[model samples]
Target: MIEICKKYDCVGCGACISACNKRAIFMHPDSLGFLYPVIDQKRCVDCGLCVKSCFNNHKPTFIEPLKTCVGHVLKVEEQVTSTSGGLASVFMREIINNEGVVYGCSGENAHEVKHIRIENIDDVNKLKGSKYVQSFMGLTCNSVVQDLKANRTVLFIGTPCQVAGLKAYLKGKEYDNLFMVDFVCHGVPSQQILNDAIDAKVADNGNLRLVNRVKEGGKESKYTLRLLKEGKIAYDQAYPSMGYITGFLSGLYYRENCYQCQFARRERVSDITLGDFWDRHDDVKGLNNKKDGLSMIMVNTENGKKLMSMCKDSCELVEWDYEDFIKRNGQLKQPIRRHPKRDQFEELYCSKGFQSAIKESLRGDLNRIRKIILFNLIDSTLSTIPIIKIIYKQLKLIK
Candidate 1:
């Protein structure tokens, strides 16, 4: 059975649980809300499969990308629905068009999201954009195996650790029909924090059903965190929610393993790496500042290169330098630094609540204070002007 270490070990990957033929392994969450595999010793039979499937024990070597670029989908609908470049939609559609299955994380509700399989093109919409929560990976690796075993094409997208878990579960065997795409992940926050945030948003609107991190109809940079009640919109916030985003950026409630993400390096294990080209720079030529938002894609394998070639007909792409790509996407090279107030923040959260944690963390953070001040200043300045209101609404900044 896999040895679950207390600190810096389990990434909640769900590989070992799937690997057990005797159903001897299951996931158990600790106080931090991160799940770790717990082996049922009586049925384990000393088979050692669990240990073999653990990426925490065996790390994958990273390989330099063969090609890199920034791009977005040609379809207006897909471009608008996506969190950034809408590149994921193009990849999903490509696979679905070929009668293949694409696996990704999707929101079941505001409180929970898990990795799911999308076999039809219509279902891919649910998997679009970003749901800034750690998805439960329940037997997804096993499902991927079955799909590949039946000679079906499968495109799997997830965080780096998740991709590694799936690879490790396959026991180093390469599947010809399986295409893996992982992102330059920053970190995953605690599920409890997500639950708390959702509950707080819909205080009187009954229960929040939809929680989107990037709602449509805003400047790509200003996509809102939209929460819903019944079927109507309830909370539409921009940039960050104080409870979730503030605590997240301040390192309040993230899983312990996230602080030390081993996969944050150039030598990636997945076929393609996707991330937002956030810190826009002028040096990269041919990059349409779609400032609408662009996805930085790094092709890691021959399979990835082939896939990129197919994008010529479906995407607006530009070949860019790896250095330029890393300019804003530094998670490609380094792990997120732990916040100095992490311990205090979590303690306050575990004791007081999510809102309390956010308040405490935001204290003395002059940058956030300045942003709030500027926001109010802009609101007051814009609200009084009759013509400017029309122009701002036209710019999609009103809502």
Candidate 2:
């Protein structure tokens, strides 16, 4: 019997499953709904392909970023609607116009997020924004390999572990046409938690048209759930009403591997890294106003520079200090510390469900509601009154 990695070390990227030719490997979910690869001893030939392709077994070397900058889509409407500066949308359009296939995460509703391929430019909208849940990567890596073998241009955008896993699955084959992108991930929660939250909150039996993270004036929100019911806003509340968002922001529960993620550091595994520039707009050189969205981009290779040059006209890019940039984005330096009560949260979740688990786990933090209100007040004040924003920044109160 061949073991890929320990249960806590597996990211469930499915590379081993795709690499196996004899169909000996299959993914089975644990009680917490996180997937892991299982090998069938009867069909195993021990070719070692599975181990060779597993990212956990052969850790890919990390590359320092060649260039770092802040950027955003030039179109106001696009920037306003995007999770950050709409750079991902620009990349998607560029790939589609060149007649390349783009693989990204999309779901019919909140509960079904998965990686899918899209070639048409119009369908790019499906891939926009972030899905808070861990995306299912079922056989998509094989699809990517097939496209690459046909001499077709391919752009894959996913979490860092997924990107590393796909490259591992390719067995050192080089593809000049392949462009890989990953983001500064805020560790993903399981599908079971998301499903339970939707079930508890969405009273109307109507289909969930969509689920989105709400932002205030393009600024990130810590506690908002914007679920659409039949194409209209249904739930727009914060914790303790939104238990999932509460747990997510609290860092109470995540996949076991996320706390020990090897890819969460300054050295990156992808050609390019994209994430929200959390610093104030004025702090960013190219962004003059403080209201709209902005994105932090780290170009890791020549291919990343090529991609950015191709997208030059679609967005504004300005140089930023790499050392200063990482200060705001801690994931660039280290993985999130494992919550002390993480195991307790999981145990409660298995028996009592999402709401009860979150409530009990966060019960000690009585100041949560107060802090949220204060943060919102500061956020609104900073957006509207410039003088107060300066004072708050000087006092080291808000960032």
Candidate 3:
């Protein structure tokens, strides 16, 4: 049996509840509008299968010498929309073209996360980009395993933990038909935070009629929440939605184990690891200025290499030397965690006892702004210094 706190670290990925052979763990929603795990100890044998299955406990072993880029690269020009790069769409398109099924996260009727199966090219839009929250994986792994058993090609995309969990659950099973892709994840945010932000937005407005079309305008445009009173844009405003970015950057959006993630090192379990290629070819003028978007595609296996090669004509592929890749991503040494002062702020929010605590924390608002300016200046200056470059490389252990 497993025990979990209702309000604390449980984002309820359901790995534990799903892993239990005795069916001891079940799902329950707390006050925060998110599901959490509830354990029935009487049926539990204490076999620890749940613990073993938890991605929190079991870290995947990464295999290296994975193929770099040997595929054709073309700049993808299509109407396809995605989180950053449209790589996932491209991958899905190829799979569908070949009559294969693509498995990925989709929002269900209740807006809950659920695994979806797409076989049509037009439906590929459903699975593109990062969802940035816990997805209800459902029994998709079981379905994928069944497909692989029948010699059908399956493309799976998800967070590292979800991928790891699938592989672990199907241990000793080998299938050539499976192609796994994991995001070079920062972390996922809690559903509560998302609900809170949405509620706050609704309250700011009069009615719950407006829906923000995040990707409608452009990538950089501030997200607008539009009020729809009878199928018309009643009121709209452009502002940063705290729910989306805050949970993403703070790692509170991730599973608790993700902070001490064992799979976050050089070697990764997935065939290909994809993420935002933040910096590439700084010495070359036009390459690094891609303010629009680009994918940092890392092929980690022969299968990944083959897929990339097959899709070469669809997208622009650039070969990044290992030294440059490390240098670009190395500055993010510590994964984002709860800020040190966040606990105190959370305490004040909970207790509602001391108004002074909030006042004290907010007293230096101007000073905080000044510090941010200075910090950005120092960061920009250091990034250019030759000596600092040497130190940065050394710190990342880049050869």
Candidate 4:
């Protein structure tokens, strides 16, 4: 009788369902909107396969990234549209050009984060940019297995845990054509919170056509968060404020497993790692200082290095110092600091709604309250002038 406990035990990778020969395990969402495995005793064979496939319990071995670079896509249009440097697009172009399959997170319309596949060159943008919530893995593990068995090339990009889950589900079978990529994740917020945020941010409460977090301008541009509708820009704001970004950056919304993540360790399990190169230290010499933003591409395995080199023509590749990059971006070396009110926030969110939960949780937080007060004060002062008032209204700073 194998069991997966809720709240920090299971990552809902859907690997267990793929591993189960008896088909006894099923994923069910918990109160916090995260999936955990549930077992049927009537069909139980006591195979213990599910437990073994768990990335949390049975961790993957470490492998240092083979190569690391700070770079961006050579195509100006692609870079502008991408979240950071447009490297994923570059990699996808190479893989898809070879008629390979690419799997990644995409669920902006449904207001859910789920794994999606892209084989068409035009659909590459579907999986582009960042998804802050934990993506629903579903039975994609089984799909990957079927694809690999057919000897098809596969490029799967996901969080470290999802990558581990896929690898674990493969039962140690290494496919030469398979390329796995993960990123410097700062943990994922719950789906419920994200859905609520969509409702809060979308204009006219329209559908969430696409969720994109892009550094709008080089270096100086604040992240412009957009919730689009039918290719029309309906909702837009500078990110890290108000709804999902604020809660996420404030560390109030994260899965319990994130605080104890083993994948956050310096050594990675995926073939490739992608993240924003903050370059806070300004120590990487001879590179153009693109204030727009650059991606920190860390090739974890030999296979990853080969794939990255193949994309040299697609991107402006520059050497990245390992120590310096890891210094500013600590998620490479360790897990993000867990919010003190994480548990409280979850409890409230489950009991009330996302907005109420987030608001109430922060009510007791004096530091955050002070900061909000200060910002409003400054904003109010600047909003007095006629020109400033117009700018404030345009920016959605004032109602």
Write down the worst ten-residue block by lDDT for model 1.
Answer: 279-288
Better of 2 and 4 by TM-score: 2
Q: TM-score, each model?
A: 0.87, 0.91, 0.71, 0.86
Choose 1 or 4, whichever is better by TM-score: 1
lDDT (Cα, tens digit) per residue for candidate 4, span 1-399? 456434475666789888888888777777777767888999988878877777666658778767778887878788877777788888888998998899998855637678988889998878888777888887888888788888889999999888999988877778898999888888887676677776765547545655547554454224444677777777775544455666676667788788778888778888988888754333345555454567888888888988987887888877877876777677878888888788888788778878777777665554764577578667656766678767655664443
By summed lDDT, the worst window of 10 consecutive residues in model 2 runs over: 281-290
Candidate 4 Cα misplacement greater than 4 A, ranges? 4-7, 200-207, 217-225, 280-289, 363-399
Candidate order (TM-score): 2, 1, 4, 3
CA deviation > 4 Å runs, candidate 3: 1-24, 29-36, 41-52, 55-59, 69-80, 107-111, 203-244, 251-255, 279-291, 330-334, 345-399
Write model 1 residue lDDT over 1-399, tens digit each, in one string: 446444467788888888888988888776657777787888878788778888766767577999888787777667766777888888888989998999999864666678999898889877877777789998999999999989999999999999999999988898778889998888888566777776666577445544545634544345345676666778775544455665555555678888788887777889998988653222235644465667888899988876777666888887887975665566767888887778877787779877787778757664774688588667756655888756655764443
The runs of at least 3 residues in candidate 1 whose Cα sits more than 4 Å from the true structure, single-residue gaps closed, are 1-7, 204-212, 215-218, 279-289, 366-399
Q: Which candidate model has the greater TM-score, 3 or 4?
A: 4
User: What is the C-alpha lDDT profile of model 3 across 104-198, one tens digit per residue?
Assistant: 87632213445688888887756654555567775666678778787778999887767877776665356677898887666654455444444
> Tens-digit lDDT track for model 2 on 1-399?
788778788888888888888989888878878888899999999999888888778769799999999888888777776778889999999988998999999845677778899999888878887777788898888899999999889999999999999999998777889999999986888877777877888787355644455456555533455677666777665654436776776677889889988988999999899988865335655464325677889999898888999999999888988987788888898888887789888899899988888788877654776687678667765755778767766866443
Of the two candidates 1 and 3, the one with more favorable lDDT, higher being better, is 1
Clashing pairs in 1: 62-267, 63-267
